[model samples]
Target: MRKLLYLTGLFILYSMQSMAQANDYVQIQAGSYQLGDTASLANPKRTVYIESFWISKFELTNAEFEKFVQATSYKTLAERYHNAMVFEPGLAEFRWLQDSTAYWRFPNGVSRGGIEAKMDHPVTCISYKDVLAYCRWADCRLPSFDEWEVAARAGSEGYYFEGFSKENMSEYANVWHGRDHLKADYSDGYLYTSPVGKFKPSPWGLFDIFGNVFEFCTGKLHGDGDRYVAHARGGSWWCSKNSCSAFNTVYIGSVRPNASFSNLGFRVVKKAFTPGDKDF
Candidate 1:
């Protein structure tokens, strides 16, 4: 019994070490950073500064998130409530309920078609509050709006690390264009979340910043007020190409963190620098 216990302890320590090492973050130059193009004050290419810190290279996977829930027995907001809002067009054949059990574990649970694949994908249907708990439990915190944008852009102005175009999105992201959802076979493309790190990493070594899931951050959606909400960065698999502003930009203007839905999830961040030890 002693030998078995020792082995288990050793294995647990090794796993924690490995997970820590895997958290690779980039160091953006300490200075002002741009937000977005013209015509949108919400993201008017404003400049912001941030202290350096280590952030996860990818969003939390189902496997990692599962571990958190296992240890904490934390019931997600959706799971607590019997249902959540689902956004699907009205079909001539059937009626879709406004609220359904759309928790992260069972996305599209009430849909007509089945969802047996992509269980390992990042868990969506998560609200900002759920993500906040995960971050705190992991001994980390969500990145601020500016920090997320800087890390995502990785000092590049292109659509992604490889640059954007109709030709390259298939390899870099899961946007609505280029055969993801417009297919009839249901087996062609964009049916579900691709495995983490399945695509190339950005210049700073981050993955899936353009699609897959909209990551929840620690920042408030808009100016501080009694009625404020947490914000999410990046776009999700269900977002359209023409409306890719959610992906192209970063900031949490006006949203409530506890809003339960399927289009939200989060990543983690670790401390890598001292706030007062500025050299730039």
Candidate 2:
């Protein structure tokens, strides 16, 4: 009888802890907003409506990914394949290179140290499949393109909310700002990924929505391909005004779902349950 009571008490404690974690999700109200960018021929700007959902205030970090990996003993696509794309500073115009040892733990490759102090840095080198696995483990899902843009907009319109200027770019985001791609000014005090929430939050209290790392979204078919490719948004430290210019929320970037890149990462979202909700 004593053992049964102790077990019941432990179960209750675990349930409460899970509930508290779930409560950390931010509630985003349902609404209609314009999606896509006019500049891109692939994704013309269009108005769309989205249902209410809950999303994490910040991007998934190395620490969060570590927990998922430890709990599930899951091997990311990069780990299974034994290679992932990384940004090589030596390459001037284009910096991306495939390094056999690059993965989430060692984003720069095996030559670099593990993410000990960079636990707060956004987890990169994650493919779409890997993101899906993490979302499943967390009981969440990747937000659709429309849903992601809506949340990123934070109840505002235009390329950025307001007050976002070249002089103040470092205050809001992390992007390339040197004379060339090979050199990072580090005016933002970070050469690569910045710690999540290091910059000011959006109007809705979301962090690193514009820069730090490109966030993966749902898959979609583009061009003549029968297979759907995954999408990412917000750009990263590699983006610059003359180069990627990914800070513009209108931009919709796409890549193969199976490919993992150093500038890529993801966050999760959950359906918002309303009063009298009978199903999920």
Candidate 3:
């Protein structure tokens, strides 16, 4: 009876610790900013107002996701579908291929011998539904498109938060440095995805806001007969300046809510607590 009580106490303590750690967030003050790129006709720039909220400082990591999985026994979309899109380094133009056994646990797919996921790396191969499940479990929600763009810009007005120069990009993000799609320049010391926060943070101290992986947002497409398609921001390691300059603050990508890609992931946000509210 004593042993059972002791184990129950330990479990409660661990649960409390996990809850505290998962709720960590950085405060973003209320502000108005441009939502889209001024250069692109498809998605022209527009003014938007965002309320003050708490956003995660870094992308959701494999270690953090593991806790949720363990707690809820939640299986990601990649696992449920029994396949995931993976990057094929040998291909020149179109490099993404679907592998039957790929999941978040094995990001590179089963053919590559199922490499273990890095704990610090951002969790990938997750669908919008999967992100929703995670947010629900974590007591948070995915950031909206306007909020995401505002945070990525970090009060800067440029193509990138830092600038458009190659040197600035190399210092701030992880993107393809060479012209060839198959070969990365490795100037950033990462060929595929680097661990979250591997590069310098934005002015708001947000990491991996521009690159590392395409982060899903809460926005959906409407008007033009397209609805329920989810929004994604930032670029990935596979993106190049010439081909897909998705690293810019104004770029917004869309995907089906059920579609899960290797380069796609998400962060979370919550309303800022008041002085009298209970701590999250």
Write down the lDDT of every candidate, Cα atoms only.
Answer: 0.63, 0.80, 0.78
Q: What is the C-alpha RMSD of each candidate to the true structure, in Å?
A: 6.7, 4.2, 5.3
Q: Per-residue lDDT tens digits of candidate 1, residues 1-280?
A: 9999998887777666655564455445577666654665555556666776778777777677777899889998878875654545332212234456566666655553333455557777677778878877777788887788778878865434446444566566665552223332122265445666776677677888767777877654334656666777777665555544456553343446566655566777776543222111
Question: Each model's TM-score, in the order given?
Answer: 0.76, 0.87, 0.85
Q: Which candidate is the best by lDDT?
A: 2
Candidate that beats the other on TM-score, 2 or 3, i.e. the better one: 2
Which 10 consecutive residues of model 3 have the lowest summed lDDT?
Answer: 271-280
Whole-model lDDT, model 3? 0.78
lDDT ranking of the models: 2, 3, 1
After the best TM-score superposition of candidate 2, give how far the Cα of residue 147 lies from its true spot, in angstroms: 0.4
User: Candidate 1 has which clashing residue pairs, if any?
Assistant: 125-262, 221-252, 221-253, 221-254, 222-253, 229-255, 229-256
Cα lDDT, model 2, residue 10: 78
lDDT tens digits, residues 117-196, model 3?
A: 47888888888899999888877888987788788878876666755455578778888887777654676787777898
User: What lDDT is reached at residue 236 by model 2?
Assistant: 89
Q: Count clashes in each candidate, considering only residues at least 3 apart in sequence or on different chains.
A: 7, 0, 0
